[model samples]
Structure formats: C-alpha cells, structure tokens
Target chain A: MTAVSATPTATPQPRNAVIRSARDSLVVAKRNLIRMMRIPEVVIFGLVQPIMFVVLFSYVFGGSMKVGGTTDPGVYREFLMAGIFAQTVTFATAGAGAGIADDMHKGLVDRFRSLPMARGAVLTGRTLADLVQTTLTVIVLAIVALIVGWRVHEGIPKALGGFALLLLLGYAFSWIGALIGLTVRTPEAATSGGLIWLFPLTFISNAFVDSSQMTPWLRHLADWNPFSATVQACRQLFGNPGVSQSPAWPMQHPVWASLIWSIVIIVVFRTLAVRKYRHATS
Target chain B: MTGAIYAEGLVKTFGDVRALDGVDLDVPEGTVLGLLGPNGAGKTTAVRVLTTLLRPDSGKAVVAGVDVLRHPNEVRRLIGLSGQFAAVDEYLTGRENLQMVGQLYQMSGRDAKVRAGELLDQFNLADAADRPAKTYSGGMRRRLDLAAALVVRPPVMFMDEPTTGLDPRNRLGLWDVIQDLVAGGTTLLLTTQYLEEADRLAHDICVIDHGKVIARGTSDQLKARTGGERVEVVVHERERLTEATEVLRGFGKGETKVEDHMRQITVPVTGGAKLLAEVIRELDSRGIEIDDIGLRRPTLDDVFISLTGHVAELKEDAV
Candidate 1:
C-alpha cells in the first residue's frame, strides 16, 4: 500500500514572499517562544553559561594574551567579546535541533504530528527562537562587558553593524545545532553532539587570542576559519577589527566573507536538518 | 457530517515495521467505532493516520468531507485528538493548558480564556486550574488531557485509550463524559485494549490483530459469532460433578468444559433456555442435585478469545 513519491523541491516563493515567509516563521516561532518562556531554567542557565565563559576568559587569560599590540588584560576583553559572542550563539542554538530529538524521546513531537499544523513549524519555529535567544545572550554579555570597563573602539554605528553581522552569523551557527538535534538519538546525545563542535571550532579559531600568537599552521587555520571570520567582523563592529588592528598587515573585507559563510552554513545545514527531521518522523 | 471519519486502505510504516498494513474504517456522524487491538497491532498508527499526524502510505481519508491528505488544515480545524499519554505541558496550569490548546485552534483571547475555565469546570478541575498539572492526580491529569482535546469542540474526536490508567471510578467518570459527547452527536474513533470498555462504549467494535482488522461487528453480532450462550451447571456435592458433566454433555451437541474441583460443568447452549431446562432435568434424573443452573451470554471477552486466541490482558508493550 506504500507508494513512494520523489521528494518535493522546497522552492521559496518570490513575490509577496516577505509577508508570507514572516507569517510562516511566526507560526513556527510562537510555539517555541511560549515553551521556552514556560521553562525558565533552560533559558536562564543557557544565557548564564555564555556570560560566565566571557567573564572567566576575560579575567583569567585576557591579562596575559598579547592582543592588538597590548599586554593589558583589559584589551583582551575586545578579542574575547567576539569569541564569546560566537560561542554563546552555538550554546543557545544547540537546543533548536535537539528539541525534535527530545520531543521524539518524550513523544511530544509525535503528538504534535497528529495535529494538522505545519510539520516544518516544529523545526522552523525552534531554530528561529534559538536565534533570538542567542541574540539576547549576546546583548546580556555585552551589558556585563560594558559594566566591567570593556568598550568597543569603533563608533556607535559600527557596534550596531557588528551586532547585526553577528546576529546573522549566529543564525548560521544554529543550523548546525538543528542538524545535530535531528540526527541524534536522545536529547542528551543531541546536546553532547551539538556542543562537541563548539569546543573544537571555538578553540581552533582566534576567538580568545591573536592567531599570530599560535604556531604558524594553527594561526593560518584560525585566520581562515569561518568561525574566526565571524569573530573578526564582530571585532570590526566593536572597533577591534583584527587585520586593521595589526598595523603591518593590510586589512580585508572579511564581513562579506563572513556573510557568505553564514549563508552557506544556513542553507546546507537547514537542508540536512529538515531532511533528517522528516525522515525521523516518517 | 455524513461520515465523520472515512478511510480507505490507510497505511503507515516505520522502517521495517508495518504499523498499519491496510486498514479501512467508516463511521457515520455521531457514532463511536472502537478500534480494538493488542499492543503493536497498529491501532495507534491507524488513529495517527486518521488524525493526519502520520500520512498514510497509500489511501484516501476524509473527515467532515475534507480530504485529509489535501486539506489537512481544514481537517485540523474539524477534529480533536488525545494521544495515549497526556500532551499537556506539565509546566502550564490546567487552565493555561486548555487555553494554549484553544489558542492553537485560533480561539480569541477572551474566548479562549472563558473556554479554558469552562473546560476546567466541566472536567472537575476548577480548583486545580491555577496549579501546574505536575501536581495533579493521575485521574485529574487524564481528565484534563481529555478536556484539552474538547476545548475546540470539534465535531470528530480521536481518543487513544483515554481510560487505560484510570481507576474504576475515574474510568466510569470518563465514560460518562464520553457518553455525553456521543449524545451530543459527536463522532468518535477510540482505540483500546479493554474489552469491557469497547463493549460498553463503541456502537461498533473492530477487532484488529497483527496490524489488520480481523473482525468488525456490533457487540451482539460478535458475541453471536461465538456460537451460542454458555450453560453453566454447578453441583452441590463433589461426587455429582462427574455425572453432571456427563449429563451436560448429553443435553446438546456443544463444547463442554468440566471443572471437577469447582463441581461445575459449562457448555454451549444451542436451544437457549429450553436446552438449559433439558440439562437440569437430566441431572435430576441422574439423582444429581444441582446447586445452580444458568445460561450465560457471550461477552466481548469471549468474542476476542474466540477470534484472536489471546485474552485482552496480554496488552504488554502495545502501542
């Protein structure tokens, strides 16, 4: 009785697409936002961990790292901000993908499936909400940093630009989280699977240091890392642009590259996550 | 409203497991059709397919004249579903649980709030409406879950063993609520393992085994298929049991089971009460004084056993 049909192409509509897509997105986003608000512990702790990471690294290692030609511990906060922002986005987004795996474990998504609501809303709403939460985490950490005497050298407009750039970059980071959550067996597994990437990706990039301080190959890898590029752009917005800060090196428009990387990551991981979610339920 | 639920050859598969092989179901408006099956027999799968949670591999289903496959949104607007477990967020209060569900159905702010209170009151959860569901009793939670499903007041409802874990009293309470809904001309498709539940609730019972429907008929029709009513004869004295068993075997050409320990002999009664009278007379002639003699009608249990060769109690890991 099973008739197998080829997969349908998910073509995005062009005209009046903003309104249509926004409605679709809100339908997905509202359920997740309500659920996240209902469970305050997850939201609070999820936001807290990133703040702790930022403060801990800034005080403990910031004083020692020679960054942007300064040995002062205060200067490292600028570098740490970019890295911490990226890390927080990863941390917050890890749940978006895993929500499905968790719901499957708890049979919640299975129940949701019985309803006639859009199936995609479960994943779509969750990822977007996580993106919003990640954005909030960035804002919170920014406040804490500002109070601790950290300031972005760039003007007000650049800081806003940096924030916008980082938001899109964070949106991209969550796509990977979505993929992990959908592909893993349990919420624990999804979480561990998702968080595992952050450790290696964050550590290898120039999130907390000048790439030149590391070995030549590690520096090269960090310089080319898309994760690092995102942090570089954030540093630029925060008046801490990496290449420009180093007087000997000619600066580059890494923001455009960061956006490209974000788009690529978003498209590829979203495709994989949706496919995995549909197949998991099917 | 002619056919609240209509499915033809509905099929759903999960990897190698055929949750639903090929099942067809039809229930006219305002009728209850019990989808009875043991665990893993795909009863929940059928419910899922009908509810549009899982698309059928190949089939056509329409609820309230809307093709479920084509216009699932419209179908969603017309029906409510209560899965095996309570889907209410334990974090939300009982009132909020209903309110959220009402909102999902697009009920307005004031309407959803009022409906939530009314449902809490109807389900006997008015006092606990402010408290989180995690603090509720098992019966209260089940009632709230059932209440959440009714918040939309959909014309058709799908209940997946709504009374399975409830105590007898709670089960009766839910049964009363269901009866009230059915009386109000609501169509229902219920999946259950309880023989008595299906017997008491469903106007038509479908006995499903191995992911396929094996039997479908009214409680009486299925009972009638078990041949005829059973004649149970009990002997006062232990020694009269042997003679009574033989005497009962002689009354009619029907299967007889003799329990020497209990001093009882039971056999199918082909000629009804007259046959029962003949058995008593034969025992009387044999000087076998009988303590009791009576005819017992076939029950849903008997029907299940006669058809599936398995009692309903073996509901382990089902669903």
Candidate 2:
C-alpha cells in the first residue's frame, strides 16, 4: 500500500565492464540451460543424431575405408572417431542458430535487449550454452565410440587435449550461427541458413576421408581448411592413424593451426554477430 | 517539476514510412497517459523509441531524469516494458521466467526467487508457477508477461497494447493490476486502440493517427470538444425516416444525419433532455412514429470521428 518513490531505491554501483559482461552472460546461460532441461527432447535429439552417425559409419564404411594405407575396420574406426567428434561439435551450430532465431521471432530477444545488461551477453551466453551441450554430446559419443572398437593411443592427458581443441572449434563456429540467426526472419530459415554451407565445409575437409587421396587441387583446399586443421589436430593429440604426409603448413603443425584458426574465427564472427544483434533488432 | 517521462519531436522512419512522425509526449509522475490510435498509428513505434529499443532519427527523450540516447542502460534500469506481444519464454516455467527477468535486472539469485514467488501470487499465477508458459492460456501468459515487467518495481512503465488479445474478463483483470501499479505512484504510458480502455484508465489521453497526435486532453474535455449532447431518433417506419430527419433538423443546432438502413436520424443539440422532449413532440406532430429516442453525451468515438474523419476500427475478436 506504500507509494513507490520515483527515484531508484538503490542504484547498483558501476562495476568493471568486463565483470558486468561476464555476470550477465552467465545469467543468460543459466536461463538457456534451464530451458534445455525443461524440454529434454532437444538434448535427447542432439545426442541421438551423433550416436546414429557413429553406428552407421562404423558398420557401413569401417571395413571399406582405408586409413594410413590400410583397409582395416578397427583402424578406420579410430580414425573416424576424431572426425565424428569434430563433426558432432560443429553441427551444434544449426541448433544455436535455430534457438536464437526462435527467440527473436518470439520477441524474447527484444526483452533481453531492453534490459540493463551488456549488449554482447545474449550472443555470448547462447554460444557458451551450446558449447556445454556440444561437450556433453562429445562425452556420450566417446563412450559410443569405445563400444564400437575406437581407441585412443595417446595418454589420457593428450586425449583430453584433443577434446578441448574440438570444443574450441565448435564454440567458434557458433558465432557464425549467431550471425545467421540475427539475419534470418524465422527459426526454420536460420536452421537452413546455418546448415546449407556447413555440409560442404565439413565434407570438403579431411573429416571423413584422406585429403591426399583426393585430386591435387581438392587436397590442397582440404589440407588448409580450418575444419581440417582441428580434425588433424585431434588425430595428432589422440595419436590416431590419419596424420597427413602432405606439405601443407596446417598439416605439418596441426595444433597451432587449429588454435589460430579458431581464435581468428571467434574474434571475427563474435564481433559481427554482436554488431548484428544491436543493428538488426533495431 | 518536470514530468517523469518526456519526449519531444521524436521521428523514426522505415524506408518510405515514417512510423513515428515528429511525436511529442510527457507523462507526469504517478499518472497514466494513454496513447490512443487505430492500427498502424505508430503507437508501438513511439513506445519502442521511448523505451530505448529503437533510436529516433531526430529529437530526444528522457525517462526518470536520464537521457535515453546517451544513457540507455541507466534509463533501462529505471523502467519496465511489457510489449504488445507477450515476451515470456514458452519453455520456461512461469516462476523461472519471472526469476530470469529479475536476475537480468541485477537482483541476487535468492532475492530473484523470493520476488518471483511474490509476483506469482500477486498476478494469480501461484498454481501455475511451476508449469511451463507454453501450457498457459492466453490470459495467463499475458499476466505472466506483465508480472515479469514489474519484477523490479520500476518507477516508469510502458505497456504497448497489453490487453489487445484478451477476452473482456481478462482485460478487466489486467486493468485492475495496472490501476494498482499507478496507485503505488508508478508513471505509465500505455498504448491501446480501445477508447474505453483509455477513458477508464488514463489521467490524460492522446489521440494519434498516421503517426501524428491530433488531440490531447482529459476524457471529458475531449468529449466536450467534439460538441454538445446529441438527439438520436430511430424511426419505426422506414418511409418516415426523411420526415423524422426534417423534424429533428428544425430543432437541431447543426445538420442532421439520417440513416435509411436503420431509419435513424441523429443531430447535435444544446438543451439536452429539454431538447429531447421538444424533438419528440415535433416528430409526433409530423406523424413520424419513433421506435427509440435518447439524448446522449458525445463519446470518445465521436471525438475520434470528428478529429480523424473516421471511426476507430475495432476488432472485438482480435485475440
């Protein structure tokens, strides 16, 4: 029954911009994670697709595909596991784009934009949340991979390092998804826009087959692909059999190339996405 | 003292259409200003500009003493907005939606939870607090969206057609909630196409059309401006409509309008009930048997027609 004062009761002290940005991002991430839990179908569907890929690829292409000059099903399984893990992580881009586009269509993005939070928080939070989901899917896929005779030859630390590189690449690609989401009008459009270019990007790389076996021009392009760099890095760190003998610099030092490519993508795309978030909504 | 919300000469355009064409507005502390307009009158555009969701191509706005263009985040901290569309997350439970809004407003997690529970009860969503918003009825989702806006107890609020799609009962419920907020000294700028809503809730009404404010006044003042009381006569016989119009025009202060379909004749008059009595006598003498006759004050509808040269197009089934 008390009359409210026109003045704010307590103005929150102006904190460091970095700290505020981080705090706001975490709040948004928490919201997305909660929504994901509520509709367990989204997470369950995400897990099902990767598991299906593992089983279908292992049984169908395992014996036919050659890795390091050998057509052994077991060796192909190990080689295929890294590519599948990288593919699983990157494919999360579509979900991220679709989720953001849905939010925009429903006016949820407007609600978030009107708040006193940091401008980049919405996109950063979304990308971070998708990264978590990708990590979970990767863990589950690794278990599924092990059941199909995929093995890590490196020590446990190196194997974990490989997973880290895969996640970083996934996080970077999500920024591109974020940009597409902001540009498109509907969730369906964003999902399609996100995936249309990715098929060629993932397939054209050395994720599924040896780059050296392809034509000279195609091999050069695949060896230098950012996606191929991550896949090759995972193979090196996991001590799998798909290490390339190509003279491409990325193939020679896959780990450093993976780091640089992911960092550049993160920097370029995050800036574009956040800028699009501000302008497109207006 | 200056008003709690103020804007001057705000202009925003999309390609060839000026969504907000040089609009000016001021809402004093603890009062409601209703922005009344028909469809596509830039009510939503004005609200968006004032709420810092869109930057005006020209002019300035201030909310709670902060410059909207220069310090939007600070202005954002002082205001709450419930847009035309219910912006609640469908996947999240009602409680979670409110809590998320509170956290975004920078409240502590525990405090956000406590506030969410309080809003759930106040908005009559206590039973549905744990249910996902997707399962909510249309009215329930609207209540939840309004509850989310009030989470911070902001001093200035903007609601853009908050009850556009609600049934009558739900609309009344929302009106009661809005009245309570204003009673607690909140400054509100509400945009609605319904004149009855503006008359019932606003301290002042601004009639806008084609992105321009045509008239601004208190409800009674606006009705007074439209003109004096009117004598409406519905003739029993369709053939007698012209006769009734002639007789009423003799007693009228202005031109009389006759509708052949309804066999009705309406005219403006000064003397109210006394004039009504005289008109009936005149019509009876002329053998114009009237089925219905009344002296009624000018409604906001009359004001809208007089100012804009058209009736406010109302869709009762918009929900």
Candidate 3:
C-alpha cells in the first residue's frame, strides 16, 4: 500500500491563544443553547419555581410578615420582589451542576477533553449558556412579580442594573456549581450537593425575612452572607423598600459589597473549578 | 523513523490498582494496531493517555511527532478519539452534533456545516441528520459518534472498543468504515476484546492482561505461538476410548488428551489433512467407530486461553 504523507494543511497554523479560547468557548456555548432550546421543559420548569415563590409569598404572608416596621401587604410585595429575583438566579446553581455532571457521566466531557480546544472553554461555555437560561427565567419572573402588585420604584436604568447584578451573582455562583458538579459522582449527587448549601446560604441572608428581627449572632451571620449582599444590593438598585438599616458595612454599602463579593467568588471559584476540570479523571 | 504513534514504558495507577504497568506500543502511519485485552485490562487507560484525556503516572508518548505529555494540545490537533461510550449530545440533531464537533475543531461555520453534511452522508446518517440523536438506535448513535470523531479527519485515530456493543450487522458496517479510514491513510489504534475483530482489522495485535503485554504479533503469529493444528476424534462407543487414543498416539507429536465422558480423544499433529485421512483409516481398520473427527487450527480464543489462562472477557471494574 502507498503511504499517505502528512499534508502541509494537516498541521494547523498557530493562532492567537486567547482568541481561540474565546471562539471555542462560544462554540460550546452555542451547542448548549441549542440543547436548551430543544428541551423547553427544562426552561419551563426553571421558570415555574420562581413564579410560584412570587405568587405564594405575595398572597400568603405579605400582610402577616413585617418588613422595616409595618405589616402592610403592598409594602411587603415590593420588598419581596428583590429577594425572589435573587433567589431565582441563585437557585439556578442546581441546574448548572446537574447539567455538567450529566455531561461528565455521559462521556461528553471526555470527548471535549480529547479535542484541541482550550481547557476552560467547556466550563466557561456551560456557565455562559446557563446564564442565558437564568436570564430568561428572571425575565418571566419579573413579569409575574409585576402582575402580583410588585413594582420597581426606581427608574428603568436602575432596575436594569439590579437585574444585571442578579445575573452577575448567578454567573458567579455557577462556578461554585461547576466545582460541585466536577467533584460529585453523578448528576443526582450534583443536584443535591448544589442545593444543600444554597438553602442555608439564601435563608440565612436578608433575602426573605428581615435579619434585624433575629437574635444578635444569627443576625450577624445573616448580615455577612454573600447571598444577602446581592439581595441588599438589588433592593437598593430597584429602589424597593426593606432596605437594611443595620450597622454592618455590607448592609450600608450593598452595591459595592455585592460587586466585590461576586467578583471575588468568580475569581476564586472559577480558578478552582477550572483547575478541577483539567485534572478530572471521569 | 519512529512510528506516527509511539509510547515507551507507560505507567498509570489509580490508587492501588495499577491500570497501566509499563506498557509500550508503536503504530506506523496508515497502519492499525489492535490493543486486544479483556475487560479492565487497561485498554481504555492506554487510549486515554495517548489521546491526552488522562495523564500517565510516568511515560513517554509521542503522537504525530509531538510529545504527548509536554505538548498535548498539539497532539490533540493530530488525533481523533471515539471512546467506549457514544459521546454525542443526545439532545442535538445528528447534523448539529457533527457541526458542533467541527466548530470545536476550529472549522468556520460554513465549512463546519458543509463537513457535517458530507459526514452524515458518508456515515449513512443523512436521513436522520435532522433528528435528535436520542431518537436514533444504538447502531445509529455509534455511527454518529464515529462520524463526529472524523469531523476533521486527523492523521491519527483512537477507538476504544469501537464495536463492543454493536450488533453483528452494525459491527460489520463499522468495520467497513474503519477500513476505509485506514485505507485513506489514517493511523489507527483500536481496542477490543473480540479476537475476530482484531484478526480481521488489525495488522498487528498486542495481547494485554493484568495491565501488561503478554504477547504481540500478527494474528497468525499469535495463533501459531499457541499451538498448531490438532486432530480431535469422538468415538461412538465409550469402551473404545482407549483404542482411539492408542491409534491417535501412534501418529501424535504430543500426549493424547482423552475426555472419557464425551468419548473424545485429541492429539497435536504437524501433518496437514493427509495425516488426518491416515488416522481415519487406521481407526477404521481397527474397528474403532468414530462419531466425529476433524483437524482444526487453533483460534485466537485458544491463543488467549493458552496465554492468559482465561477467556478474552472478564467481569471486572473498568480501569
């Protein structure tokens, strides 16, 4: 048999590394976005939970719960929207983790690892795709919030800023989810592992109830939670009531605290998640 | 010159389990090297290391003239890998999957689309190209996976048990595709437990067991190493087993083996069919009626059993 010599074109020309990484990441992201579009039920289910929280909290305990000092239902509805929006974005961490874990289980990650693409592209692309889904979910939830007597007292620009911060926080938390996904054995484990900490993280923060009502130490812990910082930031940006009067630094400067916390989480967790991804065996 | 794909003294351990214990391999350009082994024999581990999916504990590997450990990304550009699992995205259409793979390989969008169409047609997946891969059968999915691996037509390819779970017809179909790839000058490293697959496709076979290479040669060489042709006879009467053995031993080159319950006698021999006819005549003249008699060459199964003291498949945890 005649030997086929390696052709000159067979060897890829050297390109800018950063540009290739970004391009590869976008390609992966496009694939995932297509998958999400095909599986509409996942997006629908993602939307249903946040919508339910909005409706249930607005009608059930709006008047009974006290925010600031009053028990007014209208006052509480405005206060509850920010918390629900933050919760909606943060809760998407489970889906991100489960999605990655499923990819690993099905060997798609192995397929990607064998390719010449950037090492972090798979994760960055996945998180970016998930961020899009979370954005859609937040949009629908905002409509639900509007129908339930929840209004953004601030101008449209500030409200958009609030939504931006919520997404940033969501994107940051996805790295944590990505790390959990890589660490766990199965998607089911990833789902559970992703949520087990989120419950405390969101609940202990100022997302739902007023932290001032709690005792001193628990209040302190709640005030310092990263989840609370974003929630507090959203409230201030949206010009919603229930702003914290706590002496804690983050409660006073919620927007800066939120930006710092999200950036820091992205740096630390993205580093860990990308490192874990490179050495992942299965 | 060294082979296009070469490795020396590769060692990888997963905790206490030594998945690969100093393995070596070399596959020249445009040739197929079959890494034949039972389950958990480190075939997957070796493929993973060569494909840059896993790092070996200690080893030297070069693919397409690039150092695997030091320049894995460069090696990745020159190789395609289809793993044990069909790693296509189930939610994506067949065309979408191929296009996605092409884009990942850095093909332009229009180029990826054109390549996807061509591959879908070549793999006989054109009809199902627009359908989600989840709707396809196992064989279709496997074909699509193979097509995905060929998105860029790299010079080197690694298929870990490419036909393990495929049905017979699909297995033949895949064998045809693989042969076409090799004929077009793609260097291939295929791993499988089926000796017949290795015999039909591999130019050279490496028999690995317990994370070590026990034998390496062409199909005929391994079979010849096991043993030559044997004359097996099953006598009609249980009482005549002794007579049959005595008759067979007269022409036998080795000790005659007798299975009393089956009334069968087997003896190794060097002569071809001529000796078999003479043995038959001798048995007939002695009034030793034979129920069955045939001269059979040792199959690769026999080679495996002889070399590893077990069959070519074992139920164990995968490496």
For every prediction, compared with the true complex, DockQ reads 0.20, 0.48, 0.53
Query: What tens-digit string does per-residue lDDT give for candidate 2 at A104-194?
Result: 9898988998888889999899999999999999999999988988788888999998999999999999998988888895889988999
**After aligning candidate 3 to the native by TM-score, how far in Å is the CA of B4 from where it should be?**
1.2
Itemize residue pairs with steric clashes in candidate 1: A28-A125, A63-A73, A97-A178, A97-A181, A98-A181, A113-B53, A114-B53, A154-A239, B39-B318
lDDT of 3 at B251: 92
Which residue pairs collide, candidate 3? none
* Model 2 segments more than 4 A misplaced: A1-14, B239-243, B277-288, B314-319
Q: Please give, for residues B12-94, the per-residue lDDT of candidate 3 as tens digits.
A: 99989899999999888888999999999999999999999889999899888888999998777777899899999999999
lDDT of each: 0.76, 0.88, 0.89
Between candidates 2 and 3, the one scoring higher on lDDT is: 3
Mark the regions of model 1 whose C-alpha exceeds 4 Å error after superposition: A1-38, A116-119, A213-221, A241-251, A271-282, B233-237, B250-253, B261-263, B270-295, B313-319
Model 2: colliding residue pairs: none
Give the Cα error of residue B40 in candidate 3, in Å. Answer: 1.5
- Order of the predicted models by TM-score, top scorer first: 3, 2, 1
- The CAPRI class of candidate 1 is incorrect
TM-score of each candidate?
A: 0.86, 0.94, 0.97
TM-score of chain A, cand. 1 = 0.85
Alpha-carbon shift of residue B166 in model 3 (angstroms) = 1.4
Q: Candidate 2 DockQ score?
A: 0.48
Which candidate order results from sorting by DockQ in descending order?
3, 2, 1
Model 3 C-alpha lDDT per residue in residues A1-282, reported as the tens digit of each score: 112247322234355889989998899889889999998998998898888888888889889989989999888888988888998898778887988999999999999998888889999999999999999999888888888888877899999999999999999999889999999948999999999988888888788888899899989998888889989988988888889899999999988989999999999999999999888878
